[model samples]
Target: MAVTFYYAPYSTAESTKAILAELEHGLPNPLATRIELSISAGDTRKPAYLSDVNPNGRVPAIVHDGVPIWESAAITMYLGETFGVRAGNDPHQSSLYPEPGPRRGEAMKWIVWTNTTLTVAGARLAAALPVGTPGAVEKGSQDEVSKDETARKNEEEIARGDLAKNLKVLDEALKERNYLLGDQYCLADTHVWTFVSWLSVMGVSTEEYLHLTEWLARVGARPALKDQ
Candidate 1:
């Protein structure tokens, strides 16, 4: 049976889907499954949809054969292992996810950091913007901020504080190398890029993060990420 991924464009789930698209070998494009079914986050709260798989109603969940997988990290791990590209397995692709070593630990650190830091911070920032502003392009913005100007400003300040702290962390990390875990690109890079790339769309600036800005440009140049 084919693996099917339910995705919502521009959502945090895009990170895993983007990585799958960039796999060097063996990884199946879950999007291509002929029997694939999709339920965008826009409608995932429906009773019928959430009952069968993902009771929490999260997007980017995948159903492989008859088994359901929720959570982006779990999905990524499953895909990597299923394709024989898990760390310590494929030497050629090992650079992306190296064996049990400092590099691998570094990769995992950044991956978790991105999910908890960048993802959360970005969500806050997006949630802070005016409902009709450009930042409202993401999910939470519209609901959190309506036409009220004062409330929007308050949310914006709180969100900016959180986002700035994490962005600085990323900026400092980039000073040492092009990617998070060192010279090689790995899940860390892919995961963080998904949200950092959204800064410009939200009217945020990366001028202070020169290294991160440059690295993002390099990542943008990648052929595989072009599909994202």
Candidate 2:
């Protein structure tokens, strides 16, 4: 069966593309088609994509042989385990999913934390930043930091502070472990790195968090992640 990956560059969809790349790089994977959507052309918001692919009308969606899946975090876990089965490995023992054990539990923990807490805080910070302020990396996708179209006072200290709290938690969590789940690289690393790389856009410097900096280098060094 073929997988149809709907995407837009430099968006959250890159994380899902990274997973697909990793699976294919490691073995003869089931990853088949990659459909690049244009956020500028309103591709993601189109009627067909909204109805059949993602009801939420977002990129980074997957239609694995017609069954649709959305949400990058959910897609990460889905592909991690499902691709393992297609590769003749037990889903519970999947390399990306980390078998069923403590590592798996930790993976679940960090994934939920990144999606719910980290991303929420970051979005708030991005929303509060001034419309044309520079420093966000130009990773090919359109910048939404300026989407606060209505003129408003940008006293961004509060939003920045909230995100700082979350980042510090991540810093402390990674002070000792190599990855979110100890030393082994797994799905959590893949999912978390997706947004963590956008700290430049949030006006957050990584120099304060040494562990996070090193971890980014480590994860970003992976061969499969070069393009996506």
Candidate 3:
């Protein structure tokens, strides 16, 4: 049976979609069936969606053989292992995911770091930014902040500083190779690239980091990421 992918447009689920897209290039067709959930319309709150798919009421969840899996990183890792595309220690088979060795260990480290630490930093930065759309406030805001404007600006500035520090670390990491792990694109790239794309969309300038910018262009050229 094909895995069922729950996604919402303009959401973090795009990372999951990109990973699946890359897998589909060389793997079997119908690897997963997509179900677009209208998150902005409150489709995720429906009882059926909550009870059957993801109890947390979030997009980018997946159901495979009756088992539900949340978290975009986990979904990508699952797909990588299930499809036999993960890079192994055998210097023969090439894959996006490294096998159980040094390369694989490096890949695992970055994946976890991206999903946890980096994700938190991104959320903090995003939370501190002004709402792009009129009348739209922060995630949990019941109304616009008319009085705490100064406080919010300070927070945003601090968040931007922290995000820049994190970006510098990533920029330096890319100085030695094209991708996160090395010359070859790995699952770590998928996770990190998603954040980079999000940062770009959030109006963060990539021009400052030449190596990182070049790396983004290379990975962004992938057909799977083009539409995403």
Candidate 4:
């Protein structure tokens, strides 16, 4: 069966793509049966595209054979299960999301936290930021940093603070462990890394949190992170 992934690299869709990439090397035959479709706005909203597959016109959709699946979280879960590799050693028994256990519980926390709390606040702050404000150097030097700007800044601060909170928790959790889910890397890393990795491509920076910085680097260094 051929599986086609529809998404945009710099958008929230990248979450699924990153997770799939993490799964690639773990799978028996990673790229042998999968196709990725970089869905641009023009493509996703098209009647033909929507009618043929997802009707909501949202991104991160997947089509396996003739069947289409929408939603980023669902897509990642599906890929992790479909490809035996991403599931880690025993995919059939534990992949994507493992059964109830300490690691599984933490994995669920990070996965849900990344999308619900992190993405939502980040997207809002991103919307508030003055478009094309140049880079950090330029944005930092603004004379007044308006109230609206202040609010947006607060939003970003809040988001980053929350991210920091989570990161700190993970870092402490990782005191002696390597991955989020114990010694074994699993869906938790893939799910959280997807969005954290997208910050740069999304035009956001993560210079404040040292732990987060290191964690993100480690995740980015994974071999499965390949170009689309």
Candidate 5:
């Protein structure tokens, strides 16, 4: 049976959509069937979705052969393994995933780091600013402004600093390699690149990090992204 992909427009589900496109690029048959959910319209809050697919009522969940998986990173990893594109148990074996050993360990490390640390930092920063202007919120609201706006402004400043620090760390990590794990493009790149791309769309400039900027350009050019 084909996998069932639950997604919402303009959400993080775009990452999953990209991964699916990549898989279809390599496979002869379709990997999954997409089901659009309107979160703004409260589609996720429906009883069927809440109980049957994702109890958490979130987008980017998948159902494979009756098994449900949520979280973008986990979904990507699962797809990689199921497709036999993941790194093999033997370091010398050829696969999309790094072979087992320090290389594989490094891949896992970056995957977790991108999903947790980087994802959280980017989200916090994005949440503070207004919908259309990321990281560009005013430092302080007018004297008559409500406390909520003031709090948002304060949060924006803090989040901006945090985002800068996180980006720097990523910049340093990419200085010596073309991809996150050396030359080969692994699943970790999919997770990290998605978050980084989100920042780009949010008006975060990556020019200061030359290597990362180039990397984003390379990955963004993939046909899978174009399909989305």
Candidate 6:
């Protein structure tokens, strides 16, 4: 059965695009047909999309073999385990997810953490930006920013400090490893890197963290992510 991926430009769906490309490069066959939706036009709010695709009405959902799956973590894990192989297969070896054991547990842990903890930290930084900054309006500022200028500035300071603390955690984890799971690149790397790159666009810098910087470079060099 074929898969249908629902995506929207300049959104979280890009991570799914990258992972699909990565998997198809080494899998036995093609993955799915991508259907791009326009969030600005309320495509996700359409009745058919809400009833048939994602009940949550979010982009990045996929319909595979007539059953729909939503959430980045679920989609990544399914693609990885279903078609993933280690290096040196006839087609090539694509690993969308980690193998069993300690690495698998760590990958699962970090996948959710990156989706929640790391991403929320990044969102706070974006939400706290002052008016007139590029991309701030698209990201949506805090409600407090509209009512209290002083509160918005306070929020920006707190967001900055919190993000630094979270980055330190990631930086320390990458100090002795290449990818999130030590050396083998998998879905977790792609998932986390998506948001990290997003944060950089909002003015968060990773240059000062030596380990984190090197890790980002290594992941950024992947062939699958190039086109996406």
- Report every candidate's CA lDDT: 0.67, 0.74, 0.75, 0.61, 0.74, 0.77
Question: What would the per-residue lDDT of candidate 2 be over residues 173-226, giving only the tens digit for each residue?
Answer: 888888887877887888888778866655687778889888888898888786
lDDT of 4 by residue, 35-140 (tens): 3444432566678778977898667777887789887766765665565232335534335456556655666677777777766655555554565442221132
Of 1 and 3, the candidate ahead on TM-score is 3
Candidate 1 Cα misplacement greater than 4 A, ranges: 24-42, 84-95, 137-147
Worst 10 residues of 3 by lDDT: 134-143
Q: How much does candidate 6 score in TM-score? A: 0.87
> In model 4, where do residues sit more than 4 Å from their true spots?
26-41, 85-102, 133-170, 200-210, 226-228
The backbone clash count of each candidate, in order, is 0, 0, 2, 2, 1, 0
Assess the local accuracy of residue 69 in candidate 3 as a C-alpha lDDT between 0 and 100: 91
TM-score of 4: 0.71
TM-score of each: 0.80, 0.83, 0.86, 0.71, 0.85, 0.87
- Model 6 over residues 1-228: C-alpha lDDT tens digits? 489999988777877887788778745667889899987577887899999999887879999889999998788777776766465554445556766777778878887887778877766666667655743534331122453778778877888888888888999999888988876888888877887877787788999999999988888888877656
| Candidate 5 residue-wise lDDT, 1-228, digit = tens | 469999986677877887777667755568789899877567877899989898887778999999889988888777766763545365443265555578867877877787788777767666666744643222231111223878878976787677788888888888888899888877677667877888776667788988888888877787766555
lDDT winner: 6
Worst 10 residues of 6 by lDDT: 135-144
Higher-lDDT candidate among 1 and 5?
5
